[model samples]
Target: MRTLDSLILDQISGGADAGSLTTADTILVCDDPTGDLTAAACGSGRRVVVLDSDYSRCQRAISLGAQIAGDRRLDEFLAGSNGSAVAVGEMPKSLSRLDYLARSIAGAGFDTVTCVFGANNKHLARSMNETLATSFEEVSASRGRGKFRCLVATGPRNVTYEPAAGDGLVAVGGVFSGARADHGGELLRSALPAQLGRFLDLGCGNGSVSRGLDGDITATDSDADAVLSARAIGLSTTWDDAGSRFPAGTFDTIALNPPFHAGTTVDATLVSSLLDASARLLAPGGCLYLVHNSHLRYRPEVERRLGSVEQVARNQRYTVLRATAR
Candidate 1:
């Protein structure tokens, strides 16, 4: 039931020093889906470099004017420890990335270490606290802010980050992790058929729909962070869609709410590929179900491939499309 504004309000607030942020060069260590923070920061006149695990997030970051921070490798970023403060709207998953970042910082040096993890990232916080307690200067946590948490670790000190601002942006529950499923889940549940043999939710952000499906289903996205985030909640079987590779005609049903924006602009490539992939993945007589903004030009592409496409339903802002595999 949360609108975009409501979710954004409940999840993200003003970052630190909106003005004081040195316009100097900065590198953001984040996954692809969350790389928007790097782009936004870069727009503030800072020479930004983005380090991501997935190539897509890196490409999007550079497209937004962020310099390539040395390909999307965790070790690459962690090895040098630019010591410059990094920023994110939310935290990445627990893995060598956190450990590497901490080690790099300890070696390279930094003044302030500010981490904004999604409120839903308790496991991530726990992991960092358990593994890097002595490495960071200070470590602090806050709650109920959805998928965003602001942690400030000062010279090996553990301190909890306080709420920056409250306009209902801060949720009641402390930091929580999972896909931001509030609105997308409802849309998928409403648009999809009740009975399906096999399902594939493309760009399955947090696996919101795949998790709800009754039978066999596969969830996928180009964003590893999204796939990782969804899988952390038990929705597995994600593939990197960068190369657009998948077993042909392997799915009986496919669904998506496809992302509209990657970095800062409307990306038609993602939509175009989703359609092509749907056509390639669906078996004969299989169905492709999708929801997208009403204004996007998806009909022509759908018809081009499927030879038949129809609008199942529509509202002022969104449209649901259905097509059968030939």
Candidate 2:
């Protein structure tokens, strides 16, 4: 929780200490990427569960000693709860989660739900308000501090998720930046080796790389939304942190369009992790088809992992590289 997050506890959750837990209480904390506030809300006698899209975030929840489902969605997790649930959540930045959260709360048989939010994201604020209007009979808000706000709602109403369009891509409530084209991804897909056999789509989003590709294509992503979207398209999908889900030397080739950001901060190290993972996952003589911003200087680093990294294709914004595992 940042200072704004602290405001959430102070204003919405009564400083995170007002509730008395019972064995019968089922508490859900949603989108708990950091796990700090969610862990604090997990009292002694109640069952608490967390929902997070990111594998690292879910791992953080486990490390903080909170239980979460393998599916990590609210509806999926709450279906198993024996009693009615109460929930506290951070505001979602996208319409996907907001829509899903509303439907899930209704499906979960929740008695009450509150979301702590900052108005910095107008789209999120609007979606949250819309979801609340449809999902709850009574909804109220707390006074704001700086850009922060809170909404308390009860009673359930029906909600339908966003519709499919264009490529029939339906992002599963957790895809970052939505299920759209990534120039790097498109470039990498175009530049894939024609001799492909068993392959992995690392950081797969909506199976964009594996779609229409021949052979045994396995797709993996850290985002639950991306895996769900990939699976929706009939791809064999796995939730992964980098390429750790598979054994060493598992694939004949890998397609990587490495992410450079975690949250909003740009971090160049993500490409290194992807390259290392690609190396570990590729058999000898296997190939890595990688794409990134043209100025990223990934060649030197990529060469360190797989030998003879060659320049494949380059445009004004992107550069594609091919690496052969030694």
- Compare the candidates by lDDT and give the number of the best one: 2
Error of 1 at 49 (Å): 14
Error of 2 at 111 (Å): 3.4
Q: Residue-wise lDDT of candidate 2 within 193-303, one digit each (tens)? A: 787888999988777767877788899988777887788878888987987979999999899887877655678887777788999999999999998998778889988
C-alpha RMSD by candidate, in order: 11.9, 3.2
The number of clashing residue pairs in model 1 is 29
Candidate 2, residue 251: the lDDT equals 97
Candidate 2 residue-wise lDDT at 290: 90
- How does model 2 fare in lDDT? 0.71
Model 2 earns a TM-score of: 0.85
Instruction: Give candidate 2 regions above 4 Å deviation.
Output: 15-24, 63-65, 80-84, 117-127, 137-141, 145-147, 160-166, 177-179
